[model samples]
Target: MLLGTPAAPADAAESSLFRGTRQFPETALWNDSADPAELVRSIGFGAVGATCNPVIAYTAISKHLDEWAPRIARIAAENPTWGESQIGWRAVEELSIQAAKLLEPAFQASGGRNGRLSVQTDPRLHRDADALVEQAVRFSLLAENIIVKIPATAVGIRAIEEATYRGVSINVTVSFTVPQAVQAAEAIERGLDRRAADGLPEREFGSVVTIMGGRLDDWLKQVASTQRLLIEPGYLDWAGVAALKRAYAIFQERGYRARVLSAAFRNGLQWSELLGGDLVVSPPFDWQLRINENELPVVRRIDVPVDERIIAELSKISDFCRAYEPDGMTVEEFDDFGATRATLRQFLDADAQLDALVRDILIPAP
Candidate 1:
């Protein structure tokens, strides 16, 4: 408490969310078809980082192939030769680059930790291990302070190894289980060792394992009918939290630093535990907004071990299939794709800043 400071203002509390002890970075939703810079600026620069995805980026392109209108117009004015495809990729490249610039000071302060923006590879390419590695390398070329996001799939782990070997900052996304996280960590270590063997620097390589909390809940909810008979309400795996804690510890134990960033968090409950790691990435802006309304929870580290005993238990693909059966539904069970696309398109077109942002994004950064 400051002895001579004036009484706190009514909205002063909102400031806590900006620099809360918990890393409040989120899914940037770049495909919302909004000007990425305007969106980033609205979110503010401090304690702010972004998560990128192909699905969302495709969503952005479905609507944003126009001339500048809002804040992004400023960038478009400088560069008018870009086409739609270039614009789409530029939206990603630009955001990652600018987001890195936005957080450059923070990265400097943290000695290359925290203040990070995640740029993910195409999820459709999740199965091509070799291709995934190439994509990660291409995305990370000439960029610093950005984490190329990879899935924790078999192919994705292979890419993670390749990316880490190149001294690239990587954030492996869509991680759903303890073993997946552990595997990603192991792959990262292998890459670092390979780098050291080649007589290269390895300290700049960072990997973030995103444990998708809400998606698990979403997946569980999809099975609610069978779940009633097979599991309990919320029927959730509290053990997952413990699993993540253990994996994070294991990565550290192995002398590798793959940061565990809790991802797909649905609500404020995730912020309650003080899980120790380099940092944790939260999802959805609402949770961050809600955090300001309540007190920030003190996240702690749980003692869980990742050993060969557990890693071996988790490696088999057959075992995973048994745990997560894909008996959910078929394509015909959903509504028409055209109608959904039209609806989404109309909504995004309404954003005035999107066109300009796309244009400005592609111009060579000054």
Candidate 2:
């Protein structure tokens, strides 16, 4: 007797249902991975692009050094006098180019709207505007679809403006507040205007202000724990989502062209609440699978208000208050914000790790 074929998994059916609805028509799905295999998988799942940083690049390189060893060896040979950092930078650039080629089909299909790959400039140079600009321009040359990832620091803002003026697209990461997002968009517009004045086409370039969602909640949760504040279960979790919604509202009001990308999502709830806007939701591959498995509610929770008592309690902490404000922050304020400094430290740590890896590869055991 012949056996009947197995039925489709529940998660697959659920994913198909979500995909069919197209609830978030304006929002594009992007993969937040550095591995080319993972990038290909995301594309099959309808992700249009991928984001990369030193951490992701380091992980990818560490896992696939054999595949990359030939190019690394060649670069070392070609530039015998170059240091370890230079070699490491070249490795990341090459890996990013390979990932960009993989997503080129989506880039072409959207006619430059999607299929972009982001490669971040060195975090060590984040404080030096001129150096950041030089690095960003160099990374952009890796591919036409490459989006140079710049930190949202004061100096980073300047570098972003300069890079945009030079006709390079950007993805401003580590943005934590509405003010930071607005400032970054204004900087991009200024650069685009300068380009237009110089007779260059402005519409072809794109920019994104990546607001890290889950990290905000994590920060708030830690604060509450230290202060012995008894907060409602889900109240703190909504902090990031509320901030992003507020940022999107400001973007619309200003008619800014830069897209708002919600990243670092902690759970499916964050994804569900922030759906159906002109946003790009980029969670890790596992989070995407979680989002697809669950059936989303008919109505989203974008407009739900967090408790004022909770806000007031959080406002007692300076950083929390600054982050929760709907109005954008000043450049000076951005420098002092707790989240901004934390983000910079995180990037630097990742960069240091990449550097160590490069040194290990260059210097053999005695």
Clashes of each: 6, 2
The Cα error of candidate 1 at residue 187, in Å, is 0.5
lDDT of 2 by residue, 247-332 (tens): 88888788888888888778665676666677777878767665655654534445555557766656655556677675546766
Per-model C-alpha lDDT, please? 0.51, 0.76
lDDT of 1 by residue, 1-366 (tens): 111113543224334344343242322111111235433532441344556555444444444545322324443455576564344455557656755666565556666665566677655465587777777887777356677877665556777888789777888765655556666777788888899899996465545776665554444444443434333333343323434555556655766576666665665545444234455645444455455556555333334343443333332222222222222112221112222233223324423233444444545357
**CA deviation > 4 Å runs, candidate 1:** 1-19, 22-48, 55-87, 230-242, 252-255, 275-278, 299-366
lDDT of 2: 0.76
Give me the candidate number with maximum lDDT: 2
lDDT of 1: 0.51
Give the Cα-based TM-score of candidate 2 against the true structure.
Answer: 0.89
